[model samples]
Target chain A: MPIRRLLVANRGEIAVRVLRAARELGIQTVAVHSDADRESLAVKMADMVMPIGPPQAAKSYLNVDALMKAALDSGADAVHPGYGFLSENATFAEKVESAGLIFVGPTPEAIRIMGNKSLARETASKAGVPCVPGSDGVVDSVEQAVESATRIGWPIMIKASAGGGGRGIRVAHDADELRSQMTTAQAEAQAAFGDKSVYLERFIRRARHVEVQVLGDGKNAVHCFERECSLQRRRQKILEEAPSPALSADTRSRLCESAVQLARSVGYRGAGTLEYLYDDVSREFFFIEMNTRIQVEHPITEMITGIDLVREMIRIAGGEPLRFKQSDIVMRGAAIECRINAEDPDRNFMPSPGKVHEVILPGGPGVRVDSMLYPGYTVPPWYDSLLAKLVVHAEDRPTAIARMRRALRELHIEGVKTTRGLHLTLMDDPRFQAAEFDTNALEGWLAARAPAASPTTTTSP
Target chain B: MAHHEVLSPLPGTFYRRPSPDAEVFAKEGAIVKVGDVIGLVEVMKQFSEVQADAAGKIVRFLVENEDAVEPGQPLATIETA
Candidate 1:
């Protein structure tokens, strides 16, 4: 049956995104919000609003029972979990399905298999996808870890079996450090992810973050090329650009093929991203993880391909078979996205949640702003710091970069300090202008900009 | 009497108890010791216990049972033991 009404089980710009997609598809939307979000833009845009619970996410968004009750009460037949806060939760998906409502994403089993990083790596390897050389599974002990490190080479990454968003990870340069850090890493992983199992991988230096966006129909999948997301702050992506300047034509094709193969192997559905750590020295890429939901940086892909990813996900959830084949999908031009967060970059990227007194979103040719910001809007401190996503598209990478720079200047926000100034500095930096930086670039850049110029990271990469 | 503030570590909602069905961790006028959990802060569905780093007598709570809170927001006051 076609979805009559959809319940958006999220907040922020993503919530607004889902509401717009549903409206385009001629489906009604029900917005569920905690008390803190009563005046949010999503609540205003929604056809109907329901109180999920109190301000706390546990009693609100993350509470499966509360979400179900809200969906049922609002007469919604489906739930769109917009990235984060139970978006990739397997048990939540199962519960939604058992409640006789459509879960707008991949199958629960697929999520389960790929949610565990070690299991996903093994599955990717079995599907003939290239993975970073490391332990077969979670290392049994420090002795086993040492042996594996010797075989895998030096500079290793210890990762938790069930970690995401850049948590539960430690990097060691030698066996002595690995042995000393093993207990600490395991304890951290256990505390953070509730899973102590840790695995090791050959940590590649001078790495670029490349990921392929794939849409699957449970039988096959198609790739929409790749996005270079190497510019990150504290391991969290802050900016992304499509058609990476680093990839050769041959490497790009191989990357897409590998991503599609892995997605098909799991009978994936809806939109998913296969992330990789690209070695700049060897030009080899290894599987990192798979995000089984729409990513925050998806607009850059959409800008170049003209494919509405949110609409595609809604259609797939509605049981429509993905019609486009590998040949049919085309990627043109270059797109870049800057995540404008409500953070004071000068103060260690501290969250700056307050009332948005004034707003001026850049609008011109090749510029688009996906935001939930409005004058007099109070950014609640109960969730992520992301306030908006500024995206720009042009015929090529250089033009895209120039357009983004222009948009960053045109954009204006008041009342709360933001990363806008930081982005401005990055856009003007000679190194960033050449795109000659890796995943660790932002940290080095920030350190140099610091008044003290901490000795920990002096030379800005 | 001088009171010590028990500030929440992160933003979310302040809970006076572990769960909805449980009793409040500490009551007004109750004696509390260092490292004692006075309340809970719920953020991203993760509950962080608000421990009394300084021993004190439980003063009146400042926030309600499920009021929204931000980082460093005072959840309650603790009088010197």
Candidate 2:
């Protein structure tokens, strides 16, 4: 059954992106908003609007009951969870399907299996996908941790099995350090998560964040190459590009094939990304996890592959089979995306949520700006600081970089202090041009430039 | 009663406690020192302490815990020292 009306269960740029795609598919759109987002671009663009709750995300966007009510009341036949929020939530997906509405993503079972790290790792291993060497299960004692660490290698990470957000995680390079950290990790885990179970895994230094985009229609799956998001801060990807400059043709094929294999193993459907940790020196990749929804940096992949991923996902949700086979899709060129956030980079990237005075978006041959910003729009502080994503594509990486530099120059937003200057500076940097950076590189680069800069010194130039 | 209003420094959600399971930083009628943390204003996932500018007794909290606040919005009221 084709979806006639789609309820967008998200906010900000992604919500707008989904609404546009749905409209393109000749589907009417219903945008659900909190009190804070009544005047949001997405709400304005939607065919119908439903007031869910208040400004707090818990009471609004993340409120499953409120969203379902809106969906049913608005007569929406399908719901598009536009990344973040509850996109990867298995229970929410199940609820949507149970309500007799299409969930524009993978099956709930696929989401559940991939949601747990250990379960996903086990599944990947069963499918012959390489995973980071680690303990078979939770380590109960120091002896068990040590035995696993020695087998893993010299530098290993002691992590609380129950902990998240990098808490109760200790990286130790030797046996003595591992022993000392193991006790503390276990205790911290017990105190934090009330679970003393801890695990050990090899710590990869200078690891690159590479992920392959795949589309599946239950029976078959195909990979859309890979994206390199090594330049990150606080594990948040600030900039992204494709195809990975670090991957050789043979390695890229192997990596892409592995992702397809994993997707096929899960009997996946819709759009999903399999995240991998790539070691530049060793030229080895390890499957870390899978995101069972469209990713934030997905536009870069779309730019290179010339596939509207959101459109494809919507088509798949409408019960269509894989439109294009692996042979049908071809990657054309390099693309780069800079996440323009409402943040003051000079002030340690402090969130700058206020009125967007004058908006001058960069647009030319290959530049695309995905944003919800408009003149006189007040960005509410109740959510993520991502204001826009400026993406550019060219014949090659250098040309793409040059196009990005030009696009960034043309881009200008008054009133709010954005990360435009930081992106501009990065564009001129030789290291970034050569793509000689890792996951931790951006934080270090920001720290090195911190001392010379003072608080709230706007770098808008 | 002479009262001074404690304002939120940034526009975001105001939390009276540092964490969910903790007690409110300042209780009503409790004496607090200047620069004492009264609440936390979370803006775009970044938490910053909302400090009491005046040493006095907290008359009452102007906003409930987890309320959406704007810059310069009164968070609490304090009796004069």
Which predicted model would earn the best DockQ? 2
Candidate maximizing TM-score: 2
lDDT of 2 by residue, A160-257 (tens): 76555456678999989988888888887787777787777789988999999999999999999999999987778899999999999999999999
Q: Which ten residues in a row have the lowest lDDT in candidate 1 chain A?
A: A452-461
For candidate 1, the C-alpha RMSD (Å) to the true structure equals 4.9
Cα lDDT, all candidates: 0.88, 0.90
Candidate 2 shows a clash count of: 0
Pairs of colliding residues, candidate 2:
none
DockQ class, candidate 1: incorrect
Clashing pairs in 1: none
* Model 1 misplacement above 4 A: A453-461, B1-81
